[model samples]
Target: MSEPVSALQGAIFEGLVKVEEAGPCGMITLRGDLASTQVKTAATGVAGVDFPGQGEANCAGDKGLCWMSPDEILVLCPYDQAGAGVAAIDKLLAGTHYLATNVSDARARFVVSGLDAREVLAKLTPADMSPAGFAPGRFRRTRLAQVPAAFWMRDEHMFEVICFRSVAQYVFDILTAAATPGSEVGFF
Candidate 1:
């Protein structure tokens, strides 16, 4: 018996930017009224952080909450804890108008870092990625080179872009190519 291999195992391409899968992680999509106290309380209980406002993200230890829309927030945690995470939230909002669906396997995350990280993202997205604008603690659900994706800025130099599991390799390839030598993609 052997441990399961990563989807991008043995894949390494380095340049001014570095890209790697975030491995398995809990990704739960929570949908409910943003103003509901039950929603906020339950969300905070599981994520250890308050529900983020639109276009924002909050991190408390390894748990994070990324606001995806006016009525949706994505909870991120350890992969193995996804089921428990959902159960905890569901218990708290038993009768509320909320929906918590574990989307861990349906999605994939890629961490893009290094001096050229922002530049690499700039080539794929139309959203503002300037330090002054899309700074840390912010996230946006946007498209990356024609593929729907969401990016969370953990810091000025580190970001994690998430997309469907099916297109993860394609997404990686594009990011790798963008970071390759002579890509002509310039960092802001």
Candidate 2:
């Protein structure tokens, strides 16, 4: 069997909240006519944490947590919890028609936090970054450097960015450059 790919490790930059490519963080994608019930029960059973509604984000235990959608949740847990977490959720949803898969390897996430975080995002995204515009716990699907990305506002000055593995690096570079002082020439 091919070895699993380890999370990305590299130089950490100051003023940047790099969400290192999370390890096999557990993921369960509930899909079915009654998926909402399964989602509610599973989320509540997980220590009374409520599942976020559509286009919302929720964090638990101070760890990097996010809800991708009403039917999908991304939990950042240690590698050992990957299987057990999914199993626990699956058990709670015994009769529901839901699908749970380990999708940690399929996506890449990064967080940019600092005073300039919103400014940096404004360089690329068309959505307003103001509190009234992109409130905390809210997420939006938008283009970043011309590539599709999911932008989740974690707080006033932090955002969780997710995109396909292939384009992650490109998107990162673009955002990083935009955060720099002189690289703001051509970005719109």
Best by lDDT: 1
Residue-level lDDT tens digits of model 2 in 1-188: 55555344332344333333333344444443334766666654542455566666676543334555544565545545556767877888777677666565666666777666766777788878666777777878788868888777667767767777677677767777667754443322
- 1-188 per-residue lDDT for model 1 (tens digits): 54434456535567768888877778888999978888888778778887787889997656899999999989988777888989999899998788999998888788888877888888888988877768888889899998999998777788888899889899999989788877755658
As for candidate 2, its clashing pairs are none
Off by more than 4 A, model 1: 1-11, 184-187
Score residue 145 of candidate 1 by CA lDDT: 92
TM-score of 1: 0.92
TM-score of 2: 0.75
CA-lDDT, candidates in order: 0.84, 0.61
Candidate 2 worst ten-residue window by lDDT: 15-24
